[model samples]
Target: MTAVIEVQNLTKRYKDKHALDNVSLSIEGNAIYGLLGRNGAGKTTLMSILTAQNFESAGTVKVFGEHPYENSHVLSRICFVRESQKYPDDATPRHAFKAASLFFKNWDQEFAEQLINDFQLPMKQTIKKLSRGQLSAVGVIIGLASRAEITFFDEPYLGLDAVARQIFYDRLLDDYAEFPRTIILSSHLIDEVSNLIEHVIVIDNGEILMNEDTDAVRDRAVTVVGDKAKVDAWVADREVLHREALGRVVSVTVLGALSDDERAEVTASGLDLAPVSLQQLIVRLTQKAGAETSSDNQEVR
Candidate 1:
């Protein structure tokens, strides 16, 4: 696979704290990657360093096979959209779209205007006068309409309502099908984007934890249910994420999937299997002990 962006031995420090520690990652071309983690997990730091918006304390960053620092050729092909994106005083959404058109060679003005109308954004109002949701819409339109070779969206839906967020997701997928490119979306809503991303990169405590295909990560954890005695025996010596018993029945979540033989063994033991939610699995991986007793809470899509 041709890596569109590569980072080696990357590290970033803020005083005594390490924002990123000895990180090494490669992003392949033309695929949607979900960048996920809890708050303060260094997702923003990593993206900023990759896009040349921030400097890394140590490590090498390359985009399109060349160093991205001060490299106009590489920078021009990338669009970084975050909630904190800024505009000059008196500049409105119109000015933002105009600036984007001049930068992205593949900028789609029609698409931008359509999105503006869809979001009901005011084109004439100064950015300072717009609401938080309106500000988010401006960033969304620029990110989508820019059509950069690689687009990084770092939690750009902060103030958007459920409907507007869904519109962004639907529009993104539609446009992406026709104009494929690298899109890295960082979202706190894991289940919401579960099926949208082809791969997942999880960061926690300023370090990379899991980087694999969306399906592969799903297979890494599983839940087994059956009689408490049988279930306890079956899960012997295995890592258990959660456990609960109702009357004579017990449900337990374990760290690995059963093999073919193990699957047959489960049948023989009268055990039932239920798929683990991706969000739950990741929550278990990233949260502190006893911090979250369950992951059944659903997110607004």
Candidate 2:
């Protein structure tokens, strides 16, 4: 697969803070990628730079083999749907869709109309008067219907309810099957989008923590549940991410893949091995990273 977006030692600084710290990664074309991280972790910063909405303080960024800044050709092929996207005070959902149709050459008016009906959005009502969820629906509709070569959805559906969000996910997947394009989605609802994303990129404190296929990430950790003493001994030499104890029982999540023989040995030892979900693994990894950072700060003090 060819890389459509590439970064080399990219860094974005805000005053004394490093919004992005020497980050380097490549995004392949025609795949769904989850740009995931906690708040203030640089997910939005990276997306903004890629979409040419913000400038990088240092290093290089390329979208479709060219710098995105002031590059109309590259910019036109990309669509960015942000949660805080603003509109004209008098603009309505209908007006927004019409403008998007003209901007994105691949925009599908029929699909946009379908989404508007699915969300029960009022076409004539001014965007300023719409409810929070309705406003989000507007962005969701534009993002899905635009069908740009690369679409960045930065938590644009936060205001949507569960059912409405499900509709967005379903429609996105269905459309993607027919028209495959690169999608980079950033959201706090990791579990909800886990299945939809083909790859995962995790950032922490302006650094890239993990970037890999979703399946590979899932196997990066496993939980073992058994008697407290047995589980403790079993994981003593392993890198443990998290641990929980209840009476005589213990559950320890360790980072590493078990071999076939090791798996049998674990089962033979009467311990139950459980697969760690993507959300669980990411949470543990970020927590561990945060703790290490704190320790380093304390040492400097």
Candidate 3:
């Protein structure tokens, strides 16, 4: 897989706060990537820099082996669907699609029309008068139908209901199958998009917390449920991410993969081992990172 986006020691500072802190990572082409983190975690900042919408305070960023700023060639191949995408006060969905068609060389007018119909969007209504869900539909339609070589969706479907969001996800996957491209999706609905993403990149406190294959991330933790005494003995030397207890029964989530023999032993000991979902794993990892950061700050003081 070729790298379509690259960053080296990237840093974006705003006054006294760092939006991005010495972040370094490469995004491969022709795959779906989840750019995930809590609010203020630099997900949007990183995407802004990559799409040339904002400047990085320090370090380097490259898209398609060249700087993205003022580079029409690089910019043309990228589509950025912001969460609060704006349009002219008088512009309607029709005008919005028209402008997008002219900008994105790979834009599919037929596909755009189909999406409009799917969402039942009113074409002539001014964008300002449109409902929140309708406004979001416009962005989703543009993002999907543009078909740019590399697309970034920064929570553009937040206003849509569950069913509508599902439609966007389905259409995205369908189009991507026929025309493969690099898609970086930054969203708070981690569990919703977990299966859709091929890779995961997690940021926390302006730093990269986790970057790896989604499958590998899933294997990073496991939960065991059994008697308190048995669970405590089994997890005594392991790193525990989360734990819960109810009347003598204990459930402990630990970091590390158990070998086949160990898994067998666990079952033989009457403990139930459960696989961790991507969302669960990411939440635990971020919480752990936050706890450690607080501890370190206290030590520094």
Clashes per model (N, Cα, C within 3 A): 0, 0, 0
Residues forming the 10-long window of minimal summed lDDT in candidate 2: 227-236
Candidate 3 Cα outliers beyond 4 Å, as residue runs:
none
Model 2 TM-score (2 dp): 0.98
Per-residue CA lDDT of model 1 for 19-106, tens digit only, reads: 9989999999999999999888899999999898889999898899998889999999999999998789989989999999998999
lDDT of 3 at 42: 99
Please write out the lDDT profile of model 2 over residues 1-301, one tens digit for every residue: 9999999999999999999999999999999999999999999999999999999999999999999999999999999999899999999999999999999999999999899999999999999999999999999999999999999999999999999999999999999999999999998799999999999999999999999999888789999999998889899899999999999999999999999998998899999999999999999999999999999999999
Query: Where does the lowest 10-residue lDDT sum fall in candidate 3?
Result: 276-285
| lDDT at position 3, candidate 3 | 97
The candidate that achieves the highest lDDT relative to the unseen native structure: 2
The residue pairs in collision within model 2 are none
Those runs of model 2 whose alpha carbons end farther than 4 Å from true positions after fitting are none
lDDT of 1: 0.90
lDDT values for all models: 0.90, 0.96, 0.94
Which of candidates 1 and 2 reaches a greater TM-score?
A: 2
Q: RMSD to native for every prediction?
A: 5.8, 0.9, 0.9
